[model samples]
Each structure stands twice: as C-alpha cells, then as structure tokens.
Target: MKTIAINGSPRKGWNTHILVEEALKGAASKGSDTELVNLYDLNFKGCISCFECKRRGGKSFGRCAAGDDLKPVLDRIHTCDALIIGSPIYISEVTAAVRALFERLTFQYITYSKDRKTFFTRRVPTALIYTMNISEPAIESMGYAEKFKFYEDRFNQIIGPAKTLVSTETWQTTDYSKYEMTMFDGEARKKRREEIFPQDKRKAFELGAGLV
Candidate 1:
C-alpha cells in the first residue's frame, strides 16, 4: 500500500510535522510506502475559478488549470492509496495556505448539470489532522467545530468522509518560571504530554498503517 501525507503547517519541524512523521512511521512499519508533502515548501496558487477543468475531459480534466506548485501534488494525490492532511487552525479556520491548497484541489473536481447543483462522484479515502492551541471543547464552543465539518463534507462530496484527528493546545514550553502556579503544575502537564499526546500520535500512525 502507498500513503501520502500532506503537512499543511507552515512550520517545518513543529507539531504538525511531528504528527505526520509519526503517522508515516506507522505506515512504514506496516510495510507501506509513504510520502510526505510540506505545503510551505511548495509554490502553489489558489484556484482561479476559471471552470476550465469541467470543460475538458481526460486525466488532466480534473486538474487545476492554474500552472502552479499544486499541479504536481494534485497528480500525486490522484494516484495515492490513502491521503492524510494535517493543518493548524488559525483564527477559527484553516491556515490560508492550506485553504488555498484545498480550493485548488477540490474545485476542479466539481461538475454541475442544468439544475446548477455540483456533484463529485469520483472519490478517494482521506484522513484529516487538525492541530490547534485551543482545547477541543473550547473550539467547539467557539464555533470552530463547524470548520472541520465543512471540510469533512467537502471532502466527502469528492472523496468520501475523512477520519479526523485533532490535537489541541500543543505548544513547547520555553520558560516554566513565567507561568502562573496553576498553569505551571509540571506533573499534570507532563502526564498529558507523555500520555495523551503519544496516544493520539499513535492513533494517527495506526490510521496510516491501516490504509487500503
């Protein structure tokens, strides 16, 4: 099996990278070939909404018309067995770079009939990983949960439902002394770090390994 993991985080070796790396490691251990693509390192433009793809009909038909870095990535995605996308939430939404990548990737697959309804019947299996500073409950309370659902529905429309994994408030500690007493409870934070994050990371890894 071959799996492709897309890291949408701007930082190269940070939280998103670590999660994707762990997932890829899991896939590799299972004898699956895996590739990781960092969007920040690529040169890609957002979709132009030119509707040229729908007009054409071939392997290139479903590809973005814009000549940018996303074209090759799109081609790779078409051939991969399983896809994992990881992004950091910013301002209650996906980062601009990641959002643009999604736009370019998904917009070309849409087809509309006389009824003016868009449909994407050709689909693939995909997984979504979102890392944010806010806790899951707080994110939900702030209406950020819908952002994931929106992406889920969009991906489902083109590629089936994605199994989403979320990592909340993952930040490295620089100075422990500066934090408040309640916040600086080292034991509690350590427990969460060593226990919870590893479990989540392992889950992501297993998901990659199980890809068909």
Candidate 2:
C-alpha cells in the first residue's frame, strides 16, 4: 500500500509539519510506503481554467492537464491508496499552496454526468490535519470551523470519508521572546504545548494508521 502526505505549511519544521510527519510515521508503521510532500518547496499554480479536465469524451477526462509541478503529485494521487493533507489556518482557511494544490487536484476528478451526483468517483481514504491559533471552544462562536467542514464534507462526497485532526492554540513562533504581545501568555502557551501537543500527535498517528 502507498500513502502520501502533503504539508501545506511554508515552514517545514512547524506544528503542521510535525503532525504530518507523525501521521506518516503511523502509516509507515502499518507497513505502507509513505511519502511526505512539502508544497512550499514546489513551484506550482492552481487550476488555470484550462477546462481540459472537464471536457467530455476526450483524452483529458478525469485528469488535470496542467503542465506544472502539481501535475506529478496529482498523477501519483490518482493511484495512491491513502492521502494525508496537513495545513495551517491562514486568514481563516488553508494556506495558498494547499488550496492551490487542492483545486488543481480535485477539479480533475470532478464529474458532472447525469448519473453522477458527486464531484469525484475516486474511493481513496483521506485524512486532514489542521493547526490553528484558536481553541476548540472558539470554533463554533467564530463559525471558523464551517469552512473546513465544507471541505471535509466535499471530500467525503468526492472520495471516501475525510477524517480530520485539529490542533488548536499551536506554537506559532520559534522564539516568543522575540515578539511583543501584551495579551499573550507565554506560560499558558508552553503549558498547552507540553500538555496537549503530544496527544494531538498521537491522534494524527492513529488517523494515518487506521486508514491503512
């Protein structure tokens, strides 16, 4: 079995990356070949509106025709057994690189046939790892989780169920002493990091292994 993980964070060693790697570890432990792809390290663009993938009765059907770095990843995903995607919430949604990859990759599998109600026909099991600055309690009040829920639901509609592991109140900076914020409590942040982060990592690991 082959499982692929994508890191959407620009920083390779950040919380999102750590969680993705943990997921990969769990998948590897399950005797699956795992690969972690960092989108920040790749040069690619989102769907270019070429409409090549959407054309019917053509060679481009069910495939993204974009000739960029993303094409290779999408090609691999077309045949992979499992997929894990990790992203940090930036301005209330996934980062640009991830969104770009999502569009390019998902749009290819989108189907509008009369017999098909869902977007995609692929049956791959997927897991989403999201890291955010807010706590779980604030998710509903701010309605910030709705966007992610939409994506998750859409993924389920397209492929199989899309499981998500969310880490809140993430460690944002390497050195908190270098920044200034009166409202910030460094001790609480450290406390959460020490107390809760490991559990989240374990959750991610389980998410990966379970899919395999």
Candidate 3:
C-alpha cells in the first residue's frame, strides 16, 4: 500500500505537523510505503477555473491542469492507496494553504454532468486531521464541527471513505510569555500537552493504520 499525507500547517514541528507525522508512522507500521508532504514548503496556487479538466476528450480531463508545485503531489494522490490531510485551524477555518489545496484537489474530480458525480478512478480510504486551540465543546458552538463535517461529506462523495480527527486546545508554544497573548494559561496548556496530546497522537496513528 502507498499512503500519502499532506501537512497543511506552516510550522514544521508544531501540533499539526506532529500529528501528521504520527499518522504517517502508523501507516508505515502497517507495512505501507508512506510519504509526507509539507504544503508550506512548496509554492502553488488554487484552482484557476480554466475548465481544461472538464473539456470533453481533453488531454487533462479528470485531472487538475494547474502546472505548479502541487501538480506532482496531486499526480501521486491520483494513484495512491490512501490519503491523510492534516491542518491547523486558523481564524476559525483551515489555513489558507489547506484551503487552496482543497480547491485544487477536490474540484478537479467534481463533475457537473448528471451521468457522473466524480472522476476518481477508484475508491480509497482517507482521513482529515485538524489541530486547534479551542476546547472540544467550543467546536460545536463555533460551528467548526459543521464546517469539518462538510469537508468530510464532500470527501466521502468524491474521494472515498473518509474520517476526521480533531485535536483541540493545542499548546501553542513552549514559552508563552514571549508573546503578547494572555488569554491562555501556560501551565494548563502545558499540562494538557503532556497529558492529552499523546492520546491525540495515538488516535492519529490508529486513523492512519486503519486507512491502510
């Protein structure tokens, strides 16, 4: 099995990236060849709506036509056995990079014809992981759950079987005093990091292994 993971967080060793790495480890433990992609390391644009992928009998039909850094990653995903995407919540939504990837990755396979709904050749297991500073209860109150479910539903429709994993109340930094932020208690955050984050990592691992 070939599993591909996309890390949509800008910080390489932070919560989002850490969870993504854990997921990849789980995939590897299952004897799957795994690759982890850092989205921020590459420069790319969202779907430009060129319609080339939709043209009847076009060379790029059923594929994203954008020629950029993400093209190769998308090409690999087209034939991969499983997929895992991880991102941190920014401004109550997924980061800008992840949003752009969503447009490029999902929109290409979407079809307007009544005869067909997606262009993906085969069904594969997929998972979406999100790390956020908000508490678990706040997810529903803030409508984040709905937004996440929307993405999951879309992935189920167009991509394959998809699951979502959320890590909340994430520790932001090792030293909070350096920043101007005072809304959070550093000790509490640190405590959660030490106690709860490992549980999240385990869940991510299980999610990845199950995907394979």
* Winning model by lDDT: 3
Report the C-alpha displacement of residue 204, candidate 2, in angstroms.
Answer: 0.6
In model 1, how large is the Cα lDDT of residue 208?
Answer: 69
Tens-digit lDDT string for candidate 3 (2-67): 999999999999999999999999999999999999999999998899988899999999899999
Clashing pairs in 1: none
lDDT (10s digit) by residue, model 1, range 66-98: 778788888788777778888988877888888
RMSD values, in order shown: 3.3, 1.6, 0.9
- Stretches of candidate 3 off by over 4 Å are none
Ranking by TM-score: 3, 2, 1
Better of 1 and 3 by TM-score: 3
Residue range with the least summed lDDT across 10 consecutive positions in model 1: 115-124
RMSD of 1: 3.3
How well does each candidate superpose onto the true structure, as a TM-score? 0.84, 0.94, 0.98
What are the lDDT figures for the candidates, one per model? Answer: 0.77, 0.87, 0.94
- Give Cα distance to truth, residue 179, candidate 1, Å: 12
Alpha-carbon error at 5 in model 3, in Å? 0.5
